[model samples]
Target: MLYLSSFTFPNDDMEFDFFMKIKRTCYDSFYPFKVLSRHGFERIDFEPVTILYGGNGSGKSTALNVIAERTKINRDSIYNKSNFYSDYVDMCEMHLKVDIPENSRIITSDDVFDYMLNIRNLNEGIDQKREKLFEEYLDAKYSSFQMNSIADYELLKKVNATKSKTQSRFVRNQLMGNVREYSNGESAFRYFTENIGENGLYILDEPENSLSPMRQMELMKFIEDSARFFGCQFIISTHSPFLLAMRGAKLYDLDENPVEVKRWTELKNVRTYYEFFKRYEDEF
Candidate 1:
């Protein structure tokens, strides 16, 4: 069920009416990265868990970024274009399903560290604010003892209660975690689990960059559960056979003239891995 579909023209060519169609009844219509000009991929069809496969510079990342920016969809792809070209970005016509949830957010390897930093900074700021408010509250209460304004007394009580709630957390911090604190592989896995919450669409770009085989499998399980139980959808771009092989994942081989779906075992990357491993089969 393709919900929304739109395309972008090259070189400020806005006259061309790119076809955008929404088919499904289960998702929002986000903008698309139009097939303005792709060398290997011919066209694209969105899927629940679409996986893009190709060698470096095959335009997989480029396409992902376009979709992300144009549709205001979650994005984790590596490369991005300048804002100057945003207006010309391909438009999206999507199957209008669920309202885009506010908690839904885009996550990328590049931003993992930055997101953690922001959380940390936000928590620190919250703490400082809480302390300052506490001091103000104390002063207000003391002033109320000498003054006779019932309104001031009420304000003082409200501020003190608010400060108490803010300081109740064991961490006394708003931001509870950081990616840098975990190993590279752990960081990636943690991000996937923590960010891919209920009923949201998540786009992952080469999530295998920092994950081990075990962790990759873990990601597969997480993805499955999220989609099955939490109403989550995924659009990923990667070369990892582990992720490509996820049950029911729709794969588009960017190496093809017109991008086409294929079984995981049939993918070039998977075949190459099979051949390489076959050589050491007897030794193992």
Candidate 2:
């Protein structure tokens, strides 16, 4: 299930040395250069499931994007980067167990949002087309029949078909059905299930964005099974405890000064949630 065994990036000292040797304009800011270089983010040891956990500005997403870029994996949405983005990527390397599958890709919040939006937009268009189909059906069904020319053959066939079929059947025959309707959470979850495939490596950025707690738990299990049963490995950046608590996942606390690995229960984000729920335990 593990395609990538290790990932190495420039350490703090290396980044500092490179920066000192090179000259940059005062206006040019290398954002991740400072943030990711803080710890020994120089090397990351990956498992079937590797998690990057941290608060905002902690460089977790930066690390995932850097790895995705370096690996030239598939990605749904474009990740934003500073001017020094390539310079930062150049300083990173990976050791792979096997060639990364072509389906291997990175999924970000923007990708999921766009996917849901596209479904909604597609359904709207389909609705309009269906209305037009209704008008066409009525016109065809009630039209006076007079096939005098070859051009009228098409209308003659449609009239015969419409007369034989019911209005609902005629509309169904004329138009494509709308994409299956789903709520935001259902749509978001569908995105993952549809995009992720067997024997592929996936990078998920903040997958909990639109998912409710129940949906998050479902996604947690989906990811767990994907790694365990399917030949899929996942590198995820998330603040959700439901995802954080996936059994046997490697947890790197990016919030730590040195970015050390820790148990999920010991993580600051997880403890915050635990405390909140524990304080109101009796209410439940």
Candidate 3:
């Protein structure tokens, strides 16, 4: 299940050396270089499921991006890349147990959001077509013009078809079905399930963004099953307790100055949630 056995990022000393070599002063920052090294997050040892847990700007996403770039995995959205991004990736290293499958990919929050937006746009277009189809059906069904020649062949067929079928059925036949059946949360969950296949390494960034609590639990179970039964591995950056609590997932606390692995229950976010609920235990 572990295609990427381990990965190493550039440390502060290496970042400093790289900066020392650079003569360009126009660029204000060398991004990914200093991001993870600042927190002493220089390496990740993989498992069936590995989680990078942290608050915003804790380098969780930066680490994932570095790994994804180094591994050369497929990704949909365009990520922020500084002028030195490639050079930074070159300094990093990865040891793989097996060849990374071509289907392996990194899924970012932007990718999921774009997917939902695309679906919404497509459905809007389809709705417009449906309205036009309805009008066409009524017009064709009521038209009294007789087909005098082969020039009217297509129109003749449409007229006959509309006459035999009801308005809804006629319209349905003319247009494709709407693809916006699911809510945003359900759509986001569906995006993961649809993209993830067996025997592939997947990196998911903040997958809990669009999901509700119930949906988050559903996604957690789905990921657990993928890793357990299917030949799959996951590297996820998330603050969701549901995902952080996945069975047998190794979690690195990026919030720590020196990143450390800890149990899901021990994470600050999870503990905060536990305390909040415990304070009002009688309500539930």
lDDT of 1 by residue, 198-277 (tens): 87767677878778999988888888777667777777889888889888778878787655679989888899999999
TM per candidate: 0.63, 0.89, 0.92
| lDDT per residue (tens digit) for residues 99-209 in model 3 | 999999999999999999999899999999998998898899898969899999999999999989999988877789998568899999999999999999999999999
- TM-score head-to-head 1 vs 3, winner: 3
* Residue 63 shift from truth in candidate 3, angstroms: 0.9
What would the per-residue lDDT of candidate 2 be over residues 124-237, giving only the tens digit for each residue?
999999998888888999989899999999999999988999889988987889999799999999999999999999999999999999999999999999999999999999
In model 3, the Cα lDDT at residue 186 comes to 90
Q: Deviation in angstroms for 102 in model 1?
A: 2.7
Report model 2's TM-score to 2 decimal places: 0.89
